[model samples]
Target: MAREQFDLIVFDWDGTLMDSTAHITRSIQAACQDLGLPVPADQAASYVIGLGLREALQMAAPTLDPADYPRLIERYRFHYFLKDQATELFAGVREMLQALRDDGYLLAVATGKSRVGLNRALDQTSLTSLFDGTRCADETFSKPHPAMLHELTRELGQGLARTVMIGDTTHDLQMARNAGTAAIGVTYGAHAASSLEALQPEFVAQNVAELSAWLREHA
Candidate 1:
């Protein structure tokens, strides 16, 4: 079915579409350990999943000096990429995206991932051509800020009122709110449903199946 209310469907990459929450959590912990900084608990590490790498690492390894940020970033990348090959899209994600595209929705990605990381993932997943546009944290403001959505909507020629941001973190929901757009949250990622509920998203999906159904019926 075609979408009536939303014209642009923007997605967050890590937890919303990709099954990389555990991998990301582990990688953050490992990066902190590599620099002898106190490792954040799983809850803390995962909580920063939708933020930009610099911001996420700063929160995850708060004890590190600013001068050592490059090293920390390098370590995070090293640990992250070691097993990034095993990361896969959540089940039904590809099909749902295809369905939305088939239904005339302008699909795009607004992620905290860097340009390099997102492009690599998109190529690896063979999903590059599926999107009409993309905005990366490195190229624009990170989540919880409206710049990414604002830029995406402008580039796609869509209005903020007719855009929806779907993601698995508070940052994502907050960004949608900041962008003056609607949001839908998925709990099968870094954050719990209770955590996401506070932001008042349009829908909260427990899994990709539920998300797909919601989008198909109501998006």
Candidate 2:
């Protein structure tokens, strides 16, 4: 058996587990079109995938006024839900998570999603009970802030040395670094593997299968 290097494994929700990046990007574009704002490019839209909705909207559509945020959010949500019904979890994600859980590792989620949005996504899959705890951007500080990781570790009673974050975006890696924990980057998500490499994650998995193999050995 491999030695246990970590006891708490924190994951990111959208791009990390669920393959919802393209849907989210398109939804953001649709919302911009609905409001007659110039649509952001796909890269611009995807770059904000791990941020709070309002922050993401502002970054993607910088021409919009703050007062227009409410309507923008509503339209974005409308468009997202329209396509979200078709989005699915990445292949082998559930099985990998279950394997880690079976190995006695506590799993948790730290995401930029709101509590409501995260719960809705989880309710759609068999992953509702897989996470031991969760922290949301809406309920706590947003990514790159470290608050989410801090809260998750505190709640789990897990020390920083025994905790590791798994995510697809630089924000996720930065959050883990800020919280003084290790991180593993996944390439099959929003950010490019090269970009994630700058953050110096302990490992970079190209897909769920690779991620699972790394975790089996290290976590």
Candidate 3:
């Protein structure tokens, strides 16, 4: 049987669309310092990609008292949002998104960022208008859960079989699988190529140019 073409494309925000790992790591470290918790460095931060702030805080500061999770999340969000609002879009992202939008493909974001955080980044990068819709951590369940993708498709009045998820993490791939949508993993993000490949996405692209070409062929 032939594969169904995708009408909608859902994106993962941080590591996939934006090159804000350095800023994120620094913010996480600062948050930890403020909370008097152990700070995770760059490599450690990568492991937290695709996770909500509450989850990332647990991984980055495992020894913290369980009762402090909420406070930790608040502090992390406060620091990261203030600094990362100025984050840059990944190379070719704006052009690729414009092309997709111009082509009449539905574009949306399904990210681990809070709604406020996603809005801030989108506004800062001038990408707020590019997306037709968005589902953030604060708005839906975090990745590896499929709730965000499912909700996005429903909101767009699209079918899961006709949607594609574009992300850089296994969490995104797994979410796609759970939601019965196709997935494309990007290499130029937080997760390594091999790591993303391990999830067996329907496609994998090394960069935005490559991703755009693949989408042109597939979508």
Across residues 91-195, which tens digit of lDDT does each residue of candidate 1 receive? Answer: 999999998889989999999999999999999999999999999999988889999999999998999999999999999999999999999999999998998
Best by lDDT: 1
Model 2: per-residue Cα lDDT over 54-170, one tens digit each: 888999999998999999999999999887769999999999989888878889999888899999999988788989999999998888898988888889899988899999999
In candidate 1 the C-alpha lDDT for residue 132 amounts to 98
* Full-model lDDT, candidate 3: 0.84
Of candidate 3, the 10-residue stretch with the lowest lDDT total is 1-10
Runs with alpha carbons beyond 4 Å of true place in candidate 1:
none
Return whichever of 1 and 2 wins on TM-score. Answer: 1
TM-scores for all candidates: the values are: 0.98, 0.97, 0.91
Winner by TM-score = 1
How many residue pairs collide in each prediction? Answer: 0, 0, 0
lDDT of 3 by residue, 1-219 (tens): 123498888999987889986777777788888988877877787768788778777888899999988888778778877866477888888898998888888899998888877877887888888898899887767778989988889888999889999998888888999989999999877778898898889888988889988887777
